[model samples]
Target: MTTVVSTGSYDYLTSALTTMPTPVTTSSTWPQVPRWLTLRQSLRMARDPVGNLNKVLAAYGDTVHLYLGGVKPSIVTRDPALVQHILQKNHRRYHKSDLTHGLLRYLGKGLLTNEGADWLRQRRLIQPGFHRQRLAGLTRLMRAAADEWVAELAALGAAQGPVEVEAHAAMTRVAFRIVARSVFGDSLSDEELMQLSDWLTAIQLFYVTTIRQPYLRPVQHLRGRYRQHDDLARRLRELVRAAIARHRTAQAAAPADAAPPDDLLQMLLDARYEDTGEPMTEHQLIDELNILLVAGHETSANALAWAFFLLARHPEVQDRLAEEINRELPNGQEVEFAGLPRLSYALQVVQEAMRLYPPAWIIDRVATEDDEFQGVAIPKGSVFSLYVYGVHHHAGLWPDAEAFRPERFAADAQPALPTYGYLPFGGGPRLCVGSHFALTELQLVLIQTLRRYRVLPTAETPPGMNPLVTLRPAGELRLRFEQR
Candidate 1:
């Protein structure tokens, strides 16, 4: 259990608490609960890490100082307005927390987990990659990838009995391939691509193991797992360096006005920061590209797996989605981005799934200076973990919070959720740049998939959570695919 102490002036702390806009009054029941939490009871059940937040909030009320280990965990407001104020208005006073810094030893400071000027610069440069116009062109490529996977699943459903979905493996492969194709174009050979994919999967597993075994931090330096991550990083760096060299050589020999290839690598090569009048340095390119490969795939893969799981559990929802997909494509044709919104129900299914099992589940930040949040005084260096799962699942915020109902997102539906209540993509100035890209990919995959087969959970699969950097299915979330 972490214990957190307010080392600052006692009066300052009290004053800050007293100023809360809608402060918890002295007579409120929230303050009576014990600040320090024991590991044996509530903590054990919260093995998924953030799962026990809602329970804690329910018992202790909106603001509770949980002492675990030796750190003070101040679980504050789930209010959206408060969330926006913290993440957006007061963002300058906060940076990525220590937990994110620890994870970056493996992930690097891709836009997903970086802070300061470097993060700002990377976000600015990479934003164009996800621009609506840029993404629309990639739709054909995304559709082709989705179509191939759907065809494979359809074949399996017809030929095999109760085929295992291999949710993680399947989604990971598809997502990784799409990012690779978008970034590197044809620079990587088929064998090289497959090898990189396998290495990435291994590295992802190793990273998860390290994060799960919190004690691994001290001994990680001695473990083969740490070596494994280092080796994978080296290998990935080598591959990117080779690709960059190849691209440079090819570009130098090509005509000055030649049309650039339709790929992310070419786009980066051609791009220049307007203010700096400079292209991304080789090192910057490599780091950001690696970020895309890791960040892009990990979250999307988890979301896809969860969406499938949700659809499997709710067959009526699945059937409705399938009907919409069929109705749109009477001849069972491929879907385009322009027609993607036509699968509104499928989109809702994916959205609802993201709410229940957000891949980027926990958002963290470190206070740069003493800050006041809705009347609460947060000492400088104090870490704030926005429990997104807790917020999404809080009964006060979501009506029938745990139920799988997509219609809640239907037009004119009035659940009256808080501002940050449905932040699957985060919010404010630091909102996810690739949100549109992820949604586009998810919609196409789900629609094409439903058009091909029906999904049912496999008997061996259990509904468990894996909380690493992203939330994922803990075990083999296998499912049977029956051809429609």
Candidate 2:
């Protein structure tokens, strides 16, 4: 028999649990619970996300039965205590759920999907690549790229032409390029870089579309998009193989006394595995590169697109940010590493935007062992999804929740807010390692872009949101840009 146990954080779970009259029935021999209409709600989540999920939270409470193919589903919990319990105290008892596992055909054994010692080892090997000291040097490169993008936008805005900002496409291409240069240095050609990027985008979109199809709910292997996906995957594998070969040749040709290239690829080549006294295998290296390409690029691009959409809607906020950028860049030159720290308000605006539209919007996990919280039991294998959007939008958790108010994050005010309440990079040990790099990238782009042009939202062309993998503006982002 299944039993419900309550970890006392009554007030925190109130928003999610208040609606339930009696604790839910859960047991080994209990009759199967009827499928609730709420199960269908997960489908509509990508459409009207925050609003719909809020409804579920308000209706079902903290822990409730959501019959997904006859099994219970656990949704959101505002209880920071329970969140702590799940993410830290007993993380071993939980692993990334199938939704993330299903993402593996595209993402490979990227840190986002893996667990246990392998995840630990991979994370350790890759962590130094994102260190602040190492990343500080990349800021100049990032700023230069941001300036080029700004100049293009400025010219379009000056023409006053209808600009369709294929935000996804544009950002995807640029982000892939950034990671390529930053991670691999000059080992990869622009031509090879673009080819790899095109295939990555195609595969990502294909995987996004195919995974959610309803009919494939039963026959996972017979999914229609697999063949096409395989074609793209095969192309990407070939491209990566070529790049690895080129990198080896470059290393071999270098002078015996020459220093290593100061790029992430070189860094990876130099990295050692304590157990084996050897570097990562070419296949493992490709998988890690695959991880960086997708996890690094898509997430940042989506976050930037969402940030721009928010800025477009709030012209006043954009202007405030523009003023900050202008003050920092009064010389009318492209922003440099020295100028980034001065753009504090611009940074806050981006931070608040992430709070409103986080790219990795939802995170899911499955219980490996039975667990309980506040008189509710989470059976082994039960799927749990943290509705980050729902938690961010919860009225009680965030005052004036829907409003885009960057002031809430003013320097002095930031430390006062609850830590987990605004988790754009997530919480616990699994918090994003690239967060420092992503934030630096966004800050550079925001400062450089806003300094050069005002991105005015088109009344006729509303931002299209497609919650495929990340929450992105669909149809590219079409904006009326006006040069500053």
Candidate 3:
């Protein structure tokens, strides 16, 4: 089916395939943007961020000191060296800036917001849940959820006309279903799952709005908007808390011969702290679940939505990928975990899709101690915006960077990929623990969707970027899905 084109270094998790061409200019002195200019362009920057940022980085050097939202003093950089230095090389000298910590007020101190020794402890405790073995156990759940989505398409195709669907909305449902099943594992009702998804979406939209439009805070507070989301957060906790109690009750009441559930929530319950050998407290477990639902759902949903959009436009690529699926899994054979490695082209599609439109477009960090880069002055409280989107699209780094060519990621492509140029998951010890889980699920959904239908493009204008907490399609990304 999928031939290995002379495997070199196939590990995209660590490094990219092709070498970067021109690195953005590096100046001896800091190339900084004026506060007055940044101020004038703040709203425009928010509205047309990917475009505006492209112009800014092209004019200045790779790393530039600019005001975040034209107010907060910060450094925005698309330099891979600076990114590696901050996130990995001299990581001890830094911590996540208060910009990240600010979420703790609403989301609780989960892995996404937690830091220091506590964060490490949490990571260690939860890492086991996403190990190869545990993920294998979860694969069946992912496939089942994908099947449910395809059944929806089956219904649409049966209607006689072209099977047009909004990809973003469709993938959102699929991602949410997989996450819901993986987390609760049949413990939650359909209504409860829908409610949970709604709450996460509403809270994230509210949080992004507050960060983007700081001046609207007083008006929002007067209208009790914050209070409304807080109430939603509280209700979310109650729902999770109830589910946990129900799980414990079910586990306790089950016959000893019956095996326990193999979902993420069970792993959290059974996980004991390394040093203390104690399970996570109820409150902490709930916090972790909330973060899990958000991370597992949002990024994968956006990535899949964009992937289908690309497939619709690139029929040759799609046909080749479908051929791989059909050959390896001839005559409707279901996908197994072991079978995934054979479908290499699908993974490349996912990788390039993410490269073009990374969900976590930017990462924020702050100096815990004074730091220097390439002779720049050491500052104690400097803030940095690691512009991942800028780095991925830098013309200097990628040949025809604007084009979507999955072959660029082929294992045996030309020169090797630059070390720091293709980081989708944030680097260092703080790298996302669920990276493998996300990738496996992404491949599963991609392979399954393409096997049964052909995604065709529509005449509607293409969707623009909605760079929120996650990069999403500005509106519904509609496409025609013809049953094959």
Candidate 4:
């Protein structure tokens, strides 16, 4: 069993995990599995990634070299030390893999897909926008969105019959609305939000298909698959451009003494490169906005969907959560941004859900130069697939790895996990900029949700995993909401 230790705070818990020694030798070759085996594994991975990864890791140990249907060999690892080595210690020697590079057409060189100096520059300029202080200012906006969702759920419950709602779809709307309002204020219309969400979903599906099935590339090209996605991408870009244009128009019409609203778009528009003193170009801003919209909403929605699904299965835990919310936040009491720290159990539930189903289930990095980890030779240009799901579920690190247990993250019961053992938002310098923002949004939504309703499993409980651009539930997660 994993050992639990008292930690200072969630920030410290995340940033101060156990550290591992850096590798110093580059002479040993990694254990190589046959190409045929990898080919078979890839097929299984297409259908059931978590199962395939679990099997591969169990058989091959921490690291295994396998050819991934391309010229280069891929290194798949579930070892926390190796993960820390690649993602933290010698991170300068690696860049995001070609898989992420493929996303350039859709995401551009924004923070998510950018590399090297540009990435550093963007990270520095945009980091402050997501700082806890700035995020606190947006809690009202987030709570408003969550309130709307709860009200809608209550209405659904009031209808005579038991109401079954798709958890993913419901959470998607809430997450998107919170992100949209936080980023662009009320500039985007409902029609535009719907269009952006639809187009983004389509684009992600196309990207995943093209990346996973390289054999389909030729057929996709012949059928103008690129054109189809490109049209969708263009339309999304136009939506962002329209929002930006509206911001500018509104700014131009405002009185000189009036202050602009403090929001993500305003922050991005006002940010400047520290070295060059140059602001992001209009096109660049659009790319950044698109990245934010896609990243902000999609991953959080997946996590929240899974959280509710887990809660539905474990009504005891759900009841405990509702009890905590009721005891902490009485009737007519609003959960402010500052009050989030009090919702510890609610946060723990979300954290545990993410441990089971991290949206970014696998993170890829390409070696920028020859390197080594524990004598394993890592040649330059090799692709490393850090199996996050494998690590989070590793039997050695997490006892009862497959079980749903929120106490694993409880204040006094939190375990001392390895540095990279639980990377729902990744690790090291490239850690997600929106980690705090995402966590806060999730906690608020859960607080509002449980306060008004008890999430119960429907016939379709515990949805299967659909590993795609983000790890999503296989189908609509149907769950019944019992109003308090």
Best by TM-score: 3
Alpha carbon lDDT of each predicted model: 0.72, 0.69, 0.84, 0.82
Off by over 4 Å in 1: 1-36, 41-46, 68-77, 154-162, 224-228, 250-259, 460-462
After superposition, which runs of candidate 3 have C-alpha atoms over 4 Å from their true positions? 1-28
Off by over 4 Å in 2: 1-34, 39-49, 68-79, 154-164, 217-224, 255-259, 461-464, 474-476
RMSD of each: 6.9, 5.3, 4.1, 4.7
Model 3 vs. true fold: TM: 0.94
Tens digits of per-residue lDDT, candidate 3, 339-413, equal 788888999899889889998899989898887887886588898889999988876667678999888887776
Model 2 lDDT per residue over 275-328, tens place: 787888887888788878778898888888778778888999998898887777
Cα RMSD for candidate 2? 5.3
Highest lDDT scorer: 3
| TM-scores, all models, native as reference | 0.87, 0.86, 0.94, 0.92
| Candidate 1 residue lDDT tens string, 68-99 | 33234544445555566678778888887766
TM-score for predicted model 2 compared with the true structure? 0.86
The stretch of ten residues in a row with the least summed lDDT in candidate 3 is: 1-10
Query: Which scores higher on TM-score, 2 or 4?
Result: 4
